[model samples]
Target: MLLELHVWGPAFSLPSIDAQCLATMTYFSLVLPKDAWVLVASSDPSVSPTNELPALRSGATWVSRFRNIVDYLRQYSGGEWDLDRDLTGGERADNIAFSSFVESRGQSLVDLSLYVSSQNYWDKTSPAYGAILQWPNQWILPPKIHAQAKLRTEHLGLSSLDLEAIREQKDREHSAAVAAGKIPKTLIRNPRETVSTLLSKTSQQNQFRLEALTAEFFEPLESLLGHQPYFLSPDRPTTLDCLALAYLSLADIPDLPFSWLRDAMRSKAPGLTAYTDRMRRHHLGLEVKVIDALSATSTSSTSSPSLPWQAPERASFATLGKTLYDTLADSTPILKHIRLNNRLREAALAPHSGLSGKESKAVSAYALARKHDLYLSIGSVVVSLAALVGYMAHIGLVGFSLAEQEVPSGTDPDPDADIDAVVDAGQVGDFLSML
Candidate 1:
């Protein structure tokens, strides 16, 4: 029987690096025959029992979640790629613990970076989702997904204590305060104020917690991966390798909004980065440019000439728009300038070039529209500036009129007079004059 794996579609001009998607890809690469299973990428949630991506269906059996899917596969495939075959009693226990840690703590960091970090989520991640969706769905789904991810991240908490722990701590403090007669019971903070305070406090604390946990998570993994090509095992890859590689590849992505986690891994856990790069090439069969930390130069290696899982060529308007947006938003000054110039040159050459009549017309129209937009933007700015100047002049005239009314003979003025009210009256006069 053929297996069917449903995952979130690729976007952002990149392959799917979503943790679960990566895990699914990793599992498929390892155990299943290349043609045995079909992979489906879509945004629809109805396909999965849990309403999540990376769900697997083999015959009538349905499995969701990376670990659960892997366990089921292990049973179904008869332990063909099971890493636990060689593990000792202690090693098996350690593997389970490590997997749980990565799923909870490590996964939280990835979620925070991709969704909670404003720059990454808005500029890159959300737009990626929008690209995969149709017009009305694009308008609606991205925000909903973003909101859901953020709420999940918030609930996960910054430290080990989490939101529940913090709430419990607050309750304990309130009880102590009441016992000590520090304040009246009636003066206890209401639910609204309690929630407000918790949000305010956790906002900053969450960032600090992410930083600390990110470092803490990688330290042990790096040590374990040292000198060995894979974590725990020397020859064959394991489930832990799949989970670690999923996250490491994501963090290493160029131009990600949150770089602190990536930078930490690069600086403090170079071995982990190297290990992931090797796995990505070996299993995924893509040529990744790996930068040597000591030499500070990139070394390119080809795992396979042809990749089975490569995404098909995308040539839609959404793809073009996203490409332009990313190019324009490039932080590097020279690259941005060059990309913009190249785009303009392409637009100019399109009508004369060997493009189809429809393509030429589309390109020409886009260029003209963009030019008009630039002109309108400049005009709007000029008009805004003129209005601002006129308003400032009106304010000055009102101030002068108020001064004259206060001291007609230019004597000492009353210091206690409400100057703010006078200013408001002047503003009213200015508005009336304008009318």
Candidate 2:
């Protein structure tokens, strides 16, 4: 069976907008023959069982996330495709340590550059998302992604780079003025002025801090990769190389409005920059044609037939509604606990698709748990609605029928009498008096 790799569509002239997706793309390009596995720009995470990108599908089994995919493929091919199979035990240990370190530090830097910086996000990142996403998704996905990036990097204390945070701060200032009964003066600023203001807030201290952060993240990798084509191995690429490539490419490749991250890499870590460029030229570089999912099967003469890169799956009406619902669910403050639990459950029940028995059990248990959660949620809503209706009826907020009265001598029941009885039982007189 031909393996399928589903990922976010191409953006910024790269294979994927997401860092992990790009890494997975490079991994497959290195290990699997071109004909063995095809890439699909499914983009929509809803397609994946785990609701994540960089998903790998083999036969009926689906694996998601880059690390899980690596492990699954290792078992699936029985170590034939293991990139680290040649590594010594110590080298394998370094692979795990450095990959984690890269993810921890590199994510914040990427998030800062792409999503936190207002100008960069608006000018470059958002548009990239808009280009790949279709219809309503173009509007929804970009902001959602931006919000997620902001959330991930919230602990870094870099609110000055955040667009939403700046707005919120201004709003708070305005509200404080209003609360104090002082009329706040509104200042009209042009786009250039706005951009300048945002930049101006980045104090010299903040600039130094940013420089320190970037150096801390990149310098070690640069030293490790000195005079070597790849990290940890002089002979061939390994998982560490993939991790480094994923983070470095994202930092170096994009031409953003705020080029601090890219500039730092170029100036401070020339070796790392060269390594990224080399790997990209050799393996990470990919050309993908985005085709409409709806028209993928058309036999038109004008249509181009290809693999690896296709348009994202056009969301159906149901899919759109569900996406909207999930967005609302995420945004709702009350559902925070529920969402957290669901995520924890998924983490515990992570799929191991290479093992049939375990994979089946895990998937089945997850599905069953999700089903029960949905049923419980629906039942709670029904119960709450019933309670609300009952309360309304008791308070005479709504009209309702009462039990029939016995008729004397089997006389014909008067419709008007029934109405009167209902009115009396419903407390119409009291309700009207209150009104």
Candidate 3:
């Protein structure tokens, strides 16, 4: 079977919208032959058992995440697919260190630029996702991603970047002013509060903090890259290169409304920026149109001359139905708790090698909760169906009647008895009374 790589759909002219997905694509392009794998911009994480993108499927086995995919390829192909096969022991150590550093520091910077910044998210990033996704998914995924990004960068203490929060604060202030009879009710927004004013209020301190964070990440990478074509060597690229390319490309390439990260990359770390541009041009194809790529999958023709880009595997109807149910559950307060419990259970059960007694019991409890959720779902469906049938019958769209009493033994059935009679509003109570 062909190796299929499922990832988030394209945005900002990149093959994959997500940084991790792009890194996984770059790694596969470098290591595997063009025919060895196909790219599918499914943009649907539900396809993966782990519910994440950049998931790789080889026949029946499925692997998820960038590192896990790399590890699987190495072991499955017996080092033939290892990107760092030629690296020395010391170089490998450097690779591990830098990859972790990029994930932690670089990831934060990207999150801030793309998702935490309300202007960029609403004006550019969120809309980009909407363009790739179908109806309800377009509605669901972007906000979920934004919420996660907020949680991830909460500790950064750069609340100035979150204009939405600032706006809410301003609204509260405006409310207080109105209550105190200080401002006219006709003035909805605070007359003095504009985007420029908001930024001006916090620019100096926030810019300093933001620039310092960028320098902390970029200065090290700039020093390491120095005069080399790649991260570790002048000629060869490794897993570290893939990781660096993912983060930097996302930061540098996208033309967001607020581009603090991009501006910092250009001024402070020109070398890394250049590297990202060069690698992107050479390895990743110039532009990715999700619909065209997906359409290409049905034909024998190629979408790109260099990379094997195809549509992602289509989700089954069952999967779609399950997603709808899950979406409903998430929207509901009680079911949302069950969904959270299921996720918590999965996290608890994911690590198979070492399980303390307490962890094992937690896993069991989670399993029980999952079972309860299943029963609840079934019960809900049954009740919903019953309600639907009853409503249809009441509205005269459906009809039900008991078998006629054994009147034939005593006399012929009455032709005047209209058992098929429709119930009218006035007679509904009488019909119930007769029953």
Candidate 4:
């Protein structure tokens, strides 16, 4: 089972799928049973995308990231997640915030390659790698069916969002409009609150951008499983924890905050509310606030990206991106594959297929040095031993020849003479010859 997540490059950087996540998911997908699910909780550059966690979770199968992942290390036994019984208030909330660091903050936000990744891990498989993205026809989750998540947004009889204040004033305006019998222009406070239209973009360019982000993380995950995500899972093998975790994890992006998913516990997936409650108690929660627009651009290239994005340029994310092509020259191909999980990049790295000029040279240099060192060590040892043996034989023969001369030149020097006879020959030359 493959569960596809839509990925969006960060407002300031490109996202990456690095070796660790790749190796992890690679080991995971490759190792799991054939029927596992893979879900890429997808997102475009907007506050609400159809594949966002709040919507996707409605159909997502229950798999606790904390519990299931820990169980994967069953021998190590991390124990069940601290969900309901303990951890409340700020402490539990803080755990969620910190886990984001454990999940999203450390890796690159976007990937630059797709082809290269697809080709490299194409046929490879592993026992522990539950998902592998190198395969095509990768699975994706359709939009939620008849799903509408609602939150009162009113705190203790007080208005929460500024939109909430506007909604309250609308009632006053509606009353006035009724008295005068005139239709109000701003009758609905927020269309998002009342309308059921999807906030997804219809442009192909936007779609390409979203696919890139989704693929960055998803491909590596798929590679690990050795299959596409099922969008559903029977056991803890493939769970919605990955779905719940992604949005809740990356909610720090101010421009693209996902408070809806943060508050989408019983409010959204009532069955998983306890899980969200567990997530909440574990310091996993989200909040939204305005950030500096200058600090938060989607793509950050010098010009525009190869594709369109809500981010500033390709370079902004590059400031913190570890999976960029330039960074992987010194890294392993697995690292390269994981860093930017685009098919193009992965294809470029394939042996005899995509080998770049510099990478080929680097491989050649490394091989040459290894071979040279081995030969030099073996040759030097053989020559030194051969010279020592030759020198010892020469000294023994020269001494025997002198002793035979001292023995009146009548007897032949025996080739098998004893050690004592050779020593006596030296003595005859030194002392007995005078006698």
What TM-score goes with each of the models? Answer: 0.54, 0.75, 0.76, 0.20
User: Of models 3 and 4, which has the larger lDDT?
Assistant: 3
Q: Assess candidate 4 and give its lDDT.
A: 0.31
**CA-lDDT, candidates in order:** 0.63, 0.76, 0.80, 0.31
Clashes of each: 0, 1, 1, 109
lDDT of 3 by residue, 1-435 (tens): 589998888788777779899899899989898888888778888777668788898897778889888988998899999999999999999999999999999889989899988778888998889877765688888889999989999999986788778888878887888899887667655555677677666666598899899999999999999989999977789999999999999999999877889999999998998899888887876565666556654332323455676755566777678878889989997677766777666645643313576876778697777768777987887886776657557755444343254345767765644543443433555544543
Tens-place lDDT per residue, model 1, 227-329, is: 9877767887777777887877777653564466677678878888888767777665454211111112323344332223322222367755653455356
Ranking, TM-score, top scorer first:
3, 2, 1, 4
Off by over 4 Å in 1: 11-14, 155-210, 285-435
The lDDT of model 3 is 0.80
On TM-score, who's better, 3 or 4?
A: 3
Q: How much is the lDDT of residue 25 in candidate 4?
A: 29
Q: Give one digit per residue, the lDDT tens place, for model 2 in 374-408.
A: 76987887886786667557754454233243346
Residue pairs with clashing backbones, model 2 = 291-311
Highest-scoring model, TM-score: 3
List ranges where model 3 is wrong by over 4 Å. 174-192, 297-304, 313-319, 347-435
What lDDT score is found at residue 76 in candidate 1?
80
